[model samples]
Target: MKPGPVIRIDFRGGIVSPGDLYNILVAAGRLGLRRASFGLRQQMFLEVDDSIRNALCVELDALGIDYVNNLEGFPNIVSSFPAEEIFITRSWLSEGVYKDIFDAFDFRPRLKVNISDANQSFTPMLTGNINWVAAPGSPHYWHCFIRFPKTNIIYEAPVCAYTNDLASITACLEDQLMKGEMNGDALFGHPAMAHYLWKKAEAHLELPPFNLPYYEGLNRYGNKNWLGIYTREEWLSIDFLKSICRLCLETRIGQFCITPWKSIMIKSIEDADRPRWNALLDQFRINMRHAANELNFQVEDQNPDALALKIFLLKKLNRDDIRTFGICFGIKTRPRSEVFCNILIRRRAMIRLGRWSFWYRYDICCSEEFNPNKRTAWVFSRNNPRWLLPEQLRRAIIAYYDGKSIAASQQVEQSNRQPDKTAVQQIHQCGECLSVYDDPETSFGDLPAQYQCAVCDAPKDAFVPREWEKQSA
Candidate 1:
């Protein structure tokens, strides 16, 4: 099906005033737009018919709303605004701080930049080229990680960054990188450059461990309330979105935030406005409470095939009563798409099956320690039929995590029994499929004489055992 031209409306730092949204919705309605999508970088996407394209652009311009069509020279700056009340966050990284940071940026960043709270998981901290995470124990200081262009390697700055200095520091780094004067690694290594950056941006850098928090559903935040809304249908009706915008204006909610989880979050809802929000939800027949498994998924925007597959998988998982708590999943229909999820379900490049028709296989991977940021060591599953991937991923993830827990506990018990020793154990994993052959519940010796991997159907002989040294606790 042919879709219209994409119009991107950047909500700087993921914050958009209710009045602004309402005006845009009105413009969209006038242009006969039925639906809109939210981007991972907290921007709005609308497909406009060519006939009304110029008219819509004129309207948006008159309203002073910044928008671009089919061009992405500048990427929207992402932040943890959506995670404020819905997810656990540091006290100092409040809405005011976020707004101040967004306002301080005088120049648009060509590279992706993410400003997130290290304690929260709703927003990815490492996906941005210039990643800034709020430093623990330092109120307004941020830890910066610069990901070199076209590379996965991340380099940390020598010191923490002040909120006011973020824009200038980022601009300087980008200029230096683009000019080929220094790389991320060399920027920190060169004494002169290091001294210059430190002098220009004064602060001490202390990077903390990142933990992704579970973010879903209607949650209370002090006297105020916050709501997280999701839909399996992929697109929310324009009418419904407009209604919510009107409600926000009426309740003086000020702004709405879009989460990376492909959902809408409205924070600072007054206790008195609870009934109004409830009435709006009831009128639209919206269900705020979805299973955690259903809520923690990311699908590529505007991809119907991927969205359909996600719905299918979620249904199957729910039917099987699988416990997928504390995990997030992403389905990428396009190759090399940057989506933040603990587990990834990727579609293999389409293979020509005759001339007119093509066939596709799926590969699945779980991030190290279930962290999306550390995707360097991806253990992939063999290619499988598209329809069978749901069950395969479910089994693979459960077994992987379960075996990991058991291995940890076994090491702990062994260490207690023999205080002065370490144990090395051997296990097999397929090099092609990356499926581990070790499971505490299943013994390799008990397998049939000729057994193959359940995932890729590779021969048992293909499995190679590798030893891992487990230290005594």
Candidate 2:
């Protein structure tokens, strides 16, 4: 929907082995798509126009890849494997558990499915239409939450399903929900129920508080180190990904886990291989450790303008040192997107009297109890101008804490404050990866006309003058 036909490649349970990923990348490179981005559902995607849509589809078809063209069809099956052995240390949930459930699926699911660890809040519990949350048990039990089709109503299953029955339960439930007017007691009456083993579910799951772990950078857990990579531009260079796949194969790493946050993580990383990863990141000019709050927001998938707005708001929040530790933000620029987050900043058409007279504003709302799993929404700010969003969101953050949010007075000053010249300096920045030329002795203009970015090989014109600007309005 965003200027080009989006090709989505589902990574079954957000798990892809190095060899399989490498092949896909090689094919994409042959098709002239040099960059790729992951989706919120832990799916890989690339933007292709009419010029090569047919060829790309053919290439994927030839490889027997599972994909959705033009963003239509059943969504990817996402799981919390990225958080296993890292964010969640004491959970019964493990990679093997997730893989077994994924492998048991005999048919393509009609509904979006999520297999998440209940102890870890990183992957979220209720994003999928049919969710199987890993609960505590010796053999492991899963709590099922079904969000009926075409409605926000989520019905928790009366009983906890056995681990072996997860796949069949989800598939059957998806089929039942698709028949329409099928919910509540009618669900338990399905003839398929006789084959599954289930126990009474807890009256309530006292889940962990919403605290997103700092997933970026090389983190140590057990004897292995894991690496999490995120890009503010929401796109990874094909070359960088290829390098990753090659490095993983050389290092004997099994697979790469894609997170619901639109990032990639490689687990079971050898300590000796840490230096190689460091070099890989350096070669790509990839920044590993962004501010924790910077990683908290989720922009609508494939929306560059929404990402730009998110960058602006994050800059303002960092400048003011606002505490957004437990909060997650979701920006919805398009209607009907089901992005899950604690605070949702939604773009709305304000006034459209005629073709020439159209205005747009934003509405900020917070989920009940600051939990994205709940659909209840409470308005924080409404009818705010585009430029005043930072100020509005600042108040919303205040509201998130202690429910004491100050009013964003419109009568307050509104102007583009000039950048701090002393604190910031102009420099040549690579457009591809945002890497700046920072040689003290030699200016960027002194470089040859044919000089490319040392990191990404972007052309000379691709290196634009980067300047800092103040928080406007």
Q: Best-fitting candidate, measured by TM-score?
A: 2
C-alpha local distance difference test of each model: 0.74, 0.80
Candidate 2 lDDT, tens digit per residue, 1-473?
Answer: 24467898999888999989998999999989899999898999888978988898998898889888866587888888888889887777777878888899877787889888877888878878898887665357887887766555677877888988888888778878888844756786688887899888767565666888998898889998999999888899999999999999999999999998899999999889999999999999998788899899887778886888889888899899999988899888765667778898877654446543247677777776677777534556666798999899988787777642322333243243443444445767676545556555557788768665433345789878877643432
Candidate 1's error at 28, in angstroms? Answer: 1.1
| Model 1 local distance difference test score | 0.74
Which stretches in model 2 have alpha-carbon errors above 4 Å?
352-357, 404-473
What tens digits encode model 1's per-residue C-alpha lDDT throughout 1-473? 22457888888888888889889989988889988888778888888778988998999999999887853658889988787756654467887888888988987888889998866666888888889988766778888888766555567776776777788777877777776643665655555434332322345443333444545455688788887777777567789899988888888888888877767888888888888888888998887667777777877766777888888898889888888766778887664456777678876544545543257677676666666775423545646797788788888678667856997898788755755678998877765455566446556667665565533445677777788777765
Could you estimate the TM-score for every candidate?
0.81, 0.82
Cα shift from native, residue 233, model 2 (Å): 0.2
Candidate 1 weakest lDDT stretch, 10 residues: 192-201
Supply the TM-score for candidate 2: 0.82
